[model samples]
Target: MCSGDAATVPGGHADRPARPQPHGSLLNPLHLLYLACFLSQSVFLSAQFALLLYALQLPLSPTMAGLLISLGGLGPALIAVNIGKFIDRRGARSPMLVALAAQLAGAALPALSQSLPVLFLSSFISGTAFIVFRIASQQTVGRLGDGSTRAKHFGHLGLVYSVATVAVPLAAGYAIDHAGFAATFLGNALLALLPLVAIASSIIAIPGPAASAASGGRGNSAFALLRDPALRRLMVATVIINGAWDVFMFLAPVYGSQLQWPASRIGTLTGSFAAGAMFVRAIVSLLTARFTSWQILVMALALAGACFALMPAFVTLPLLLAIAFLGGMGMGVALPVTMALIFETAPVDRAGEVIGLRTLINNVSQASIPLLAGAVGALIGLAPVFWGLATAMLGMSWSSRAYWRSHRRKGQSPGGTP
Candidate 1:
């Protein structure tokens, strides 16, 4: 049995999972890779979203441009499972290497191409690479942190991303406005190099069967997660919960722009969303102390959906900020809860692979929902689209009942739920 190690990091406190004595074999390498991913992600967000704006300005056609923006997400959807399986058996190095290469391709192509097709292709590849990178990093969290410490590690890792989200976009946008597009792409390429170096320096092997065996391989077998009625309900709720994000991230700015908000505030509004995410995570660190992940998650989702549905009433800065705060608070519970469920539902050995698969599934929804939301917004307007999201979240409210049923059947604990 794994011993529990309790630890705390920049915005979190959680009961730790006991880890084996450090072999100094696989763990070291994985450590470097995780660091690399953190650095890359930090730098990546700086200019990643700007790609869509670049397309639109090429102003590429609205439909085509939107697709270009979405291309990054598309690639990950195709290869999420493959990435998980590779990490499951081959270790994180291979998929990470490929992911890095794809990111390089994604960054470089746009720098080189004025053509739409090339941009689309590049975006697709980069999107997939990012997904794999996320998987690799998340798996590494398991490897690096003891089970007892996983939440703390995940919290710290997340903190880094949160910090990056704050800084990268501002920097990236500034760079794009001042420097040529090539410079921005090159900048991303430069950032991508950090993870490559981290991976090269650190020496953890990708984890394998010692944990859990991938069913039909991690990539193709996420469907098995569905076979567990409990897991299925969890996933469905997660999808809806996750789906609302698109409305927030992808469409909120569009709505703001339509509202004739100032250009800088537009960035801030999006940044506000990120800020909300960061805040929620910090809150997660605190809330986990008293509340169970399940309790927090259920309440958070309910609150977030309410916020989104009612956001139409409060479109101004003060109101938006309040809504953002509410969303952020809810999100703190939502993300960790989803992740904990994904990691816990699977056997310990398979946690890494399953989480990877989860990333893949998440990317698919994240990529597609923007288009759907955009379509809905096109027809009924932005507020209605948000209402749709709110409604879906309302549906998600019922999910907790199902999850509780599963928890009882499995005899899982409350806070840890594992």
Candidate 2:
């Protein structure tokens, strides 16, 4: 994963060193990163929703529709690590532009022709592009500051994503109902152009590969990072926490249906979850200021576990909504805190690779959790699924005692310095 003194390939091109970033530059790279991510996220999420609806309208089998959706994650899961290495070598801007272009083409494909193969390809391309953009942006932002500032930036990014999660599907549904599939898809393709242009205009100054050698020594392989006990613990916690999130997403609809709740009620319930996440992220800095990142994360997991344990016991809308909201708050805090910990713990030079590993973990859970939960829930009932996830989350929180304790013994913050 390490390169020896990577030549100063600034902006992913030219032999010259990167220009010194002006301290008082009107446009901060962090702001540009957020803007680009918001736009890219909008296009990617809306495309998936629009495509799924279109597939159903075209009378495609549910299986085929699901496959089309699945393809989106499949492509990214396979190449995320390689893309990370590529970003480490070249720079974020160039690879980001390429990814956005691929996403644009992906969106435009179904507009040109709605053939089954074309639809699948479009999903894969758009999905892969979105993930690549995400990893690059995360890497860039992680590099932008030291501990506290970096944590704050990630909190803001989490808030941005929460806003998108709440808004995009509703917008896409409205667009599909009014404009039709081709137009919606084409509109997303057009939307992709905004971020593409923004990044291309050099609104964000991505550091070149020459920055990689500042950390000193040959970097370890991405997989080899697991040898570090702290990182390994973090990765394990990531899977459990992310799996809990995915499992709730899978269970919510089915659980609602079992209670005979209407579609509007279900939608509101999910909206409440998003609202809770947004609320937590909005105040994350205040939380981080008082409590260390690990302390917050472990407490959040405990809260989520308690919420899950209570979910199956209630059938009332208000009660269920409260539980979902609480769970969402827990996850919301956990997500950004996890990012801060990873960035703080990883070698500066290997941040991208570690992020890629985290992405890979998330993708795997996204693809597998539903299948596992469905089969197990069918056989054992949904209560166990809820309780099972609860046990896992609570177990993770309890297990983290050693990590935080070790840090306390050394008088080091569990997330490293700051």
Candidate 3:
């Protein structure tokens, strides 16, 4: 898991290297971290969509269903900054161990669940743990290698999630159709095994804070990200894109229901989103070899925003499908790119806090934006929420552009420095 931070690679492709994969493959300890991250996260993320579908068969209303999803999410959102700070103070090991435990506990609830209360508590446990694992994975990437490999390493990690996310839902759908909700949780239980492997295999240790004391003391909260102008700008960008992505994902069920779409069709609509996101991100991996991440961000956000602007106008199934594809593509590309930027911009020792802060902002929007969509959807209708989301994304495009432009100037010093 150990390697030098620097390596030779073409520009614009900084995150992912242009070189071919070396003799060491997934068996390599460093690469195994990527494998572990990919497998465990897919279990959490894919089951997320599958869980709601399972809930749909329950007595819960649409809003209640949404509330449950939000509730599961709330624990992580509230605790991420604190957990992140602890990672910065301590290291990835402890938080990651805690996260896996939480995930295992949470995943089991649905397997054991016979009632609503049990389901919710399980979901709550999951929400708390998943974020810790996510932050730790990112920190592991930072600790195990240098900037030369971070982007490419992250790109590889993204590929694993993309592939697994695609498979999990289809399998869950089958399980839901035949074996029922608890069966899907069985897969989740299986996913929990990945963390154990990671914990056992990690040869890389999280460096103590004194390793980079110049970044300042461990007492610095997640709020300390505000001290860096570039980092603040990146967080703002994450919120904008993430919020816009949620507007449709959160409200689309109502839209489909209004259109009198069946459960199967509604499932397909969301499935289409995952499909599009999965494919587009795969493309981004190749594109990264040619384009700088900033360029990719512009392309992804512009198309995503444009897609949001178009969502309301579709009445026919084909039109809806087209919207889903565009929206999904945009959604897929934003996440990995954002992670690359965060790791690229922040100091390695302090990466946990930066990711925590960035994730905290994203979690706020993940919580709040849907509420905005529901309220706004109640008012002008869901169609207009797409337009509103599109408008917000447009603002994001400009702000993100400006933020990067300012930083580019700073990075362009006679002797370049971030």
Instruction: Give me the candidate number with maximum lDDT.
Output: 2
User: Which residue pairs overlap in candidate 3's backbone?
Assistant: 5-146, 15-151, 15-152
Per-prediction CA RMSD (Å): 5.8, 4.9, 5.5
After superposing candidate 2 on the true structure, give the runs of residues whose Cα lies further than 4 Å from its correct spot. Answer: 1-26, 213-220
Candidate 1 TM-score versus the reference: 0.78
Error of 2 at 2 (Å): 22
Q: Using Cα atoms with residue i matched to residue i, what is each candidate's TM-score against the true structure? A: 0.78, 0.90, 0.78
**Error at 55, model 3, angstroms:** 7.4
lDDT of each: 0.64, 0.79, 0.67
Q: How many pairs of residues in model 2 come into backbone collision?
A: 0
Model 2, 1-418: lDDT tens digits are: 1111254322211112234323475467777778888888998999899889888888899999989898898667778877877776676778889989998999999999998888889999999999999998887777665554556678889998888877899888888889988898999899889888877877556765436533342455789877777678888888887888878877888988988889999888877777778999999889978876778878999999999999999999999899999998998888887887776676655676778888997788777887899899999999999999899888988878667887688765554433
lDDT of 3 at 281: 65
Give a tens-digit lDDT track for model 3, residues 24-52: 55466556666667666766765576668
Question: Predictions ranked by lDDT, top down?
Answer: 2, 3, 1
TM-score: which candidate is best? 2
